[model samples]
Target chain A: MSRLIIPLSAFFFFMAESTYADLFSGEHFNSSRIFVPHFLFIFILFLTIFGSTKYGIIYGFIFGFLFDVVYTEILGVYAFLFAFLALVVSRLMKLVHSNIFIAALISTAAIAALEILVYEANGLIKDTGMNFTEFATIRLLPTLLLNFAFIIILAFPIKRIIEKANFESD
Target chain B: MPQFFLNKRLIVLLVSIIILVALIGFSVREREKLSWPEQFLKDTTGFVQNIFHQPVQFVAGFVENVNDLQHTYQENKRLKTRLDEYVKLKTEVQELEKENVELRDILDKKESLRDFDPIQATIIARNPDMWHEKTIINRGKIHGVQKDMAVITSKGLIGKIKITTQFTSTVQLLSSMDPKNRISVGIYGKGTIYGFIEGFDQKERLLLMKKIPYDVKIKKGSEVVTSGLGGVFPRGLPVGKVEKVESDQYGLTQVAYVKPSAELYDLNHVIVVKRKISTTESSSGAGAEGDDL
Candidate 1:
């Protein structure tokens, strides 16, 4: 039953919950935006328990790659970074049995930071129109705010999901 | 011997930590190599998306219906008037069909246009970040939508098919503001204008076409269509119209702003061009990449 829920949630999160658009086009003033990444947050935790280190690594990779595939900015940079981030998050969670809220907040913040870093690095290497100072002020700051705000919203579900997994395991 | 055979919890913790470190190292070392596996994950996610989408779309349609009830009567009246116009148009079409058949009989030797085997699909998901980024459509390799095939709406160029699986395909929209959009656009009256189109900002949704030679006579409302230079898109599909033209500050070339004909935000359906892949094009790895599984 727990196995079924993880995959189902993973599927549902990617399919239904991730409906909001990212960056540049939408009005930035919508205060009621919910930052839940749905099954992705749960999926990360699921991978840590039942799957291998390889599964987490691939999860991170695909998380970022899917982002690039949909968004098409820095190519595979985000995909790679997400895969990397998931691996670390999974490891940390495995070590310390902490509150899911803090865990999710940290995970979201770390991934958001990593995403910004990759964007900066891509600009640096390619030397396109990306200005680091401008990116920080315009892009990263708002994104960080948005991502953390989302983390808070999703914390409840994260706790529920982790607890459910723990319950089933016990 | 007793020390070496430590606690089970410690062993699990140590093993988990080691796995974590290795995952970190692997992620950093080969970021570029992660595309294949990521593609696999996306494909699976897409399947899950398809199953869930039907119910979601049904609910959306229901909501739309409920919302439309307020305006439905008014819209119905308008549609009746439009339907009368369509009736007249249908009569005209019948006359034109007879004329077309006669013309076809006279001109017996028609060039074999490539068959466009299209699979009807729904737009399952769109990238939340970029409007012109990519769309995950509900048809894939099983439906014969190959990677690099051109996707278009009835209006104009949609984008190229980037990835495909058994049940879905992800498409990049032409509204990409990247510097790499070197599309061959043919203007009305004038033969051809070659330029790049990309996004500028949200407020003014304009595609900047770089470097129209200063000497060319391009007015405010010239029609632009794909020239089919690379055969990605068919010849003479309506791309957009020229918005404005100005000489570059550097004096090397002039630039024209093109307003895309397709209203991408409201897009519900799109047609994928199913041109035959040449032997050489198929051999080069485009064939193997976008499998749904």
Candidate 2:
């Protein structure tokens, strides 16, 4: 039962993200600009800061690969992005104190950085045909706000679960 | 072993970077055709998404139905009025269609308009990453769904299939602002004026129809439909209505902003149109000249 906790949690997180994505797939609030909630990344970030970075990176790789396979045209884009972001967040955690507010702030910054990386990577391969300003205003800002709200709502419960899992593993 | 030469973190970083670059390169090349492992993963995950999506969609649809109940009376009245007009128009359309078919038979035309079979599919999932603007439908190669086949809702044209796995396929929406997915369209009015829908304007929520001949008299609200000049999409499928038309910056050609007839935001069931192979071959020969523009 204890061993099943981590994998089950990760599976649930994956299901949650995909379900939410299906529910709010298209335009939101009748606005043309889309807001994609990075729920899975937020959970992975919580694990990295609170449970163990190594485990977080592993989960990131597995789930990111799944996301690539399920949702994206090209494979490895999300897998690579999520794992790389986990690494960055884990390293940053060592330098900064692990407080809820600070962690939320760090996660927001990390997600913003990740979004920019994805935008650049897509532009390199596919020529997204969107300029920097349009991307920043239309895509980046809304995504940040939506994810930040998600982090605030789920941060406490997620941190509690990771802490419990860490204690049990010990 | 020399400690300096065998630094663990440095070695890890180097290996991961190399792996990342290789992964990106591999995926870019494999975007169109998936290997066996990729296909296996896509099929399994697509199955799971379908499992999760169906239940949620049922609940969402139930709630929407409840909300719609209040307006049912008004909607019923409106539809009833339209039904009368529709019955009259239906006979007229059938008569005209029969006549058109007879004329084509006499002329020995090999291909007529609407020369394709539509495979119906429900949208299972949509990419959360908005930049991709892709939706996954529960139809694939097994169901005769292939890449570049046009997808449409009952109202109008929506998109084309971008990639297909065993059980699912990705649809690249018309709103995707990608230049490579341009659809050739023509305005249906007093005269036939053709152009290409190059990209979408998110701000105005309109499709940009570019490179129209400057002298063509395109009026606002004229119906725009596929010209059949594009080998992939059949001709006469309604695309949108022209909202505005203006000359290009260079003044060489005209550009029209079109409001897509399909409600792109609310997609559920869609039809994937598979063009007949012989027609595609024939059309490609004739459309080769127009395709250059």
Candidate 3:
């Protein structure tokens, strides 16, 4: 159950972000401002902070690969970035004071990095037509706002779950 | 900083970066279709997405109904006036269509570009990433939803099937910023002015139809429809109307901004148009030009 907990919840968040994408798709919803949900990545952040590092990184790789295969045309883009972000965040947490607010900041920054890296990776392959100003105004800001709200709601619960799971693994 | 590189973390990161570059390179290359393993993964994930999509779609449908209610009285009045006019136009269209069929019969023509078999599909998942405009439909190759087939909503043409797995296919919407997504379209009301819908204007949310001869005069609100010159999409599929027109760079030709007839934002059910002629015989590779793998 302990081992299954993380992967299981990761699957839930994976399903969640994709599913909830439909909710914002209404007639009145702002077509220009896009909200991309990274609930699974947020869960991974809590795990990196509260659970064992090895488990956190592994879950990141597994779920990241899943996201790439399912949602995106290209493979390994998210797989590499998700695990890389996990490792980076875990290392950074060691230096900074790790708290709910600080984790929110780190997670937001990590998401920004992830979005830009993916955009740059896309530009490397083909014509991504969108300029930087458009990307930041239309895509980046709304994504951060949505993920930050999710963090505020789910932070304590996710931290408690990861800590409990890690305790059981011991 | 040096201590950060002292451990196996650096090696893992470097090796993974190398692998990522290789994988990206491999995945980005042009290919006919997804592999069997990719097909399987997509199908399984599609199944999960379908389960989650329905309840949310139901709630959204409810919300849309509520929003629609506000304009119902005015819309009803307008539609009621149009209904009487529609009866006369319907008969005229029927007569013209009958005459067209008779002329084609005399010419010994069996199929027209307008003939297509529509495969109904429900959109199960939309790409959460804003970079690309793509939606996953619950129909695939098995259901006659082939790559490069025209996709439409009731309102008008929306997109083409970009990729097909075993049980799911991705519909690349007309709003996609890909330069290769050009479609041969003709504007009516002045004896059919021809041009190609080259790209979309991200800022204004209008499709850019270009390559019109410079001297040709185009009025705003002219009906633009597919010309059937593109082998994949049939003739006379309503694409949009000319919202505005301007000269291209160097003034060699004209560019018209067309507001797409279909509501691209909230897609639920769509039709996959498989043209009979394209299916019975090999296509001419004209429409296949937009296909990127």
Candidate 4:
């Protein structure tokens, strides 16, 4: 039962991502630009900060692969991005003390970095034809706001779960 | 401690980067087709998404319907007025359609205006990433959905099928400014002025129809529809209305910004049009170019 917690949580994240994806279709906004919520990444970042970096990377790789297969056209983009993000956040955690505030800040910055990296990589490959300023204003900003709200709502509960999972493993 | 020089993490990172690059390269080259593993994953995840999406969508629809209840009286009144006009126009259109068919039969024309079978599908999931502008529909290869087949709402054209699994397919929305996904469209007033819907202008929320002849006079509010010249999308599918026209950057041709009639963002149910152009008909039709009556 204890061992099942992590995988179950990962499944919850997947379900949450899809649920949020449906909820926030920008239907109320009536705008052309979309605001994609990276709820799964935020959950993985929580796992890295609280549980263990190695476990975080493992979860990141698995869930990111699932995300790529389901949401993206390319297979490796999200897998690489999520693992890289987990690795970066873990490294950054070494330099800074981890707390709800600092961890939230790090996660926000990491998500922004992830989105920018993806935007640039896609532009290089597919020539998505979106300029940087337009991307920043239309997609990146709204996405950050949406993820920040999720981080706030889920941060404490996720931190508690990760710590408990780590304790149980030990 | 030179043991630090043999960093295991660094080597793993380097190896993973190589693998990732190769994976991205392979996937990019094989964008049109999905590998079996990808298909399996997509189908499994699509099944999950369907389970999650349907209940949520039902609740959301219920809430929206409750919200719309206030406007129901006004909406019913307006719709009743439009229904009267629609009924009058329906008979006229039926008569014209029969006459047109008779005329086409007299001329021995094999192709009619709307010659495609439509597969109805409900959108199960949308990629929130925005950059992809993709929606996963419930129908796939089993339902005869193929790449490049047009997907439309009852209002207008929306997108085309990009990739398909056994039970699910991805639609590349017209709002996606992919250079390869250009749709051949024509303005349907006066003489037919043809152009390609090359890209979408995100700022203006309009599609950019480019390469129209400079001499062609495109009026604002003129209806734009698929010309069927590309042979992928059938003719007479409503695309949009021409919002504005401008001279090309080179001053050689005109470009029209079209506002698509379909509410692209809020798609629920869509029809996938499968064009069935026979090989013999195409081979014979190829010789008779510019003979459109």
Ranked by TM-score, the better of candidates 1 and 2 is 2
Q: What is the DockQ of each candidate?
A: 0.22, 0.57, 0.61, 0.63
Question: Model 3 residue B201 lDDT?
Answer: 78
Q: Choose the strongest candidate by lDDT.
A: 4
What is the docking quality class of candidate 1? incorrect
Candidate 3 chain B: worst-modelled 10 consecutive residues by lDDT: B284-293
TM-score, candidate 2, is: 0.90
lDDT for each residue of candidate 4 in A116-152, tens digit (9 for 90 to 100): 9999889878877679998998888988988999899
The model with the greater lDDT, 3 or 4, is: 4
Q: Candidate order by lDDT, highest to lowest?
A: 4, 3, 2, 1
Better of 1 and 3 by TM-score: 3
In angstroms, give how far residue B186 of model 3 lies from its true place. 1.7
- What is the C-alpha lDDT profile of model 3 across B44-78, one tens digit per residue? 98988888788888888998899999999999999
Q: How do the candidates rank by TM-score, highest first?
A: 3, 4, 2, 1
Candidate models: Cα lDDT each: 0.58, 0.81, 0.83, 0.84
Question: In model 4, which residue pairs have backbone atoms overlapping below 3 Å?
Answer: none
Better by TM-score, candidate 4 or 2: 4
Which residue segments of model 3 deviate by more than 4 Å?
A25-27, A167-170, B279-293
Model 4 chain B weakest lDDT span, ten residues long: B284-293
Candidate 2: which stretches are off by over 4 Å? A167-170, B1-7, B29-32, B108-110, B277-293
lDDT for position B216 in model 4: 83
Classified by CAPRI criteria, candidate 3 counts as: medium
